[model samples]
Target: MTVNSANARIFGSDADAIYLAPIGTPLPTGIDSVLDPAFEDVGWLHSDGITEAFTGSKTEIRGHQGARVVRTRIETPGTTIGFHALESKAQTKGLRYDEKEVTVANGVRRTRRGAGQKVSARSVVVDVFDADDITVKERHVIERFEIVPDGDRVFTNSDIAGFPFLGEIIGDYITFESSGLATDTVWNVSVTGTPTGGTYALSVNDFSTAPLVYNAAASAVAAALNALAGVTGLSGITATGTSPTVITFPSAVTLAANGSALTGGTDPDAVASTTP
Candidate 1:
């Protein structure tokens, strides 16, 4: 009698697919798979039983239909596993365990460079917790702690020690508007509080169009002046305003070669305006 062993083949005449290895085996390498393991461990099976199932569909990729496989492993008492897709093919796909922890001991801190540093969707949010209390100490972004980086800087609890306590750091909040620009015209402006008591030059004509309106010209002038890196050095000086007709500085600025006060009527349509 011929006996079938481990390679026994059993199929009906109308079999549509072939079954290979037993369940729970890792699939072959070529198959695309995503895996997100538990925070610290894996294989935390339910106390009851395991329910395994798989479904397939034809999804459109580019212009052609591609077969997509979705497999689900459900544990009793309802624990749904989540899987994160691998970034590239070079990396192996499998469960990802995130059980890392951070210790904090200083004031939870963050920094901002300028007025443009506003929290947005992509911003990384950190939450600090008191070690013994298990209560949340603070929830904030890096901006609330400091201002102006010489170049690029990272706001991290790891940088400081003592006081803040060992805590958790959660990340990446919702999205927001990153950048944009609005162009307007400014006809008149006044600048004051220069580091050196000398004339500083500004000209709005280069940004002006023909037959410029008074208010638009003022906006352009204010925006141009505020854009200068040196403008921040002029302590007590104000060169920006929403009212577009006139740009006012904290002090008087010379408009022409005669050292006249920079004002609306005296605003020259030339490229060189000076502040003293």
Candidate 2:
């Protein structure tokens, strides 16, 4: 199947779409003749965020597409944590699983420039017990989790030990992918804290338009996140640069539990203006 490089457009009827196509419709890859054995792993070849570059001019060389990178974000204050892939339950909060675990070997380099002809190799290992199940359900996760606070840099897709929401994004992963994908991605944020009475809004001017709401102190955090979904451009996002978007849950209660602070705002609450 062919895909567009910039717009990330998908062409050709894929297996996923062929069944939906007319019965006699022809598939580019002749996938229908193969019958069963539907390929153990199914990937839509969306913009895996992988890129294919063209050295030659646009006219002479073939076209390029089917490229994409995983977009990630964190709602917390520091860059310590980031896009991470968890295997089991140890790392995940809401989801139930055993624990997540991984291992790697490290070494120190002693380059010739460092007063030595050859570099020395030192060994170091890092492990996190986020998920480890010897007995129960065995699965693979493809979500993003980054402990940026630590020394780790970019998290690769191969490191995906297991799937998050069956590889669907949620939590911090949700905000990472949900952001509109033009200039930057959109991240509908969500925050939780003991309810308090004063009204609050997102801390930074991360979004193109600041959408802030404040009534009681409590309901502020969640409202700001929800406003991003329909927000038009990538310029309007929830998290500001290095700092995080903050929302103080409303402390006041309505008829029953604490009331929602995410109410009443202009049609578009200019980015950092409201709370959620």
The digit string of per-residue lDDT tens for model 2 on 1-276 reads 987443333322222111111122332221112222221222222222212222222222333454433343333322111123233332222122222333334743222222212211111111111112111111112123221111232357765443222121122311111111233223333323433232334432222213333332223334344353322111222233211243322121111112244334432121221332
- Which 10 successive residues of model 2 have the least lDDT summed? 120-129
Q: RMSD to native for every prediction? A: 26.4, 22.8
Candidate 2 residue spans exceeding 4 A from truth: 1-51, 54-205, 208-215, 230-276
Evaluate candidate 2 by giving its C-alpha RMSD to the native, one decimal.
22.8
Query: Lowest lDDT 10-mer window, candidate 1?
Result: 88-97
Please report the TM-score between candidate 1 and the true structure: 0.15
Q: Each model's TM-score?
A: 0.15, 0.15
lDDT of 1 by residue, 136-239 (tens): 12223311111111122224676321111011112221212111112222234433322222222443212121232233334554454556431111212234
Q: Evaluate all candidate structures by whole-model CA lDDT and list the values in order.
A: 0.25, 0.25
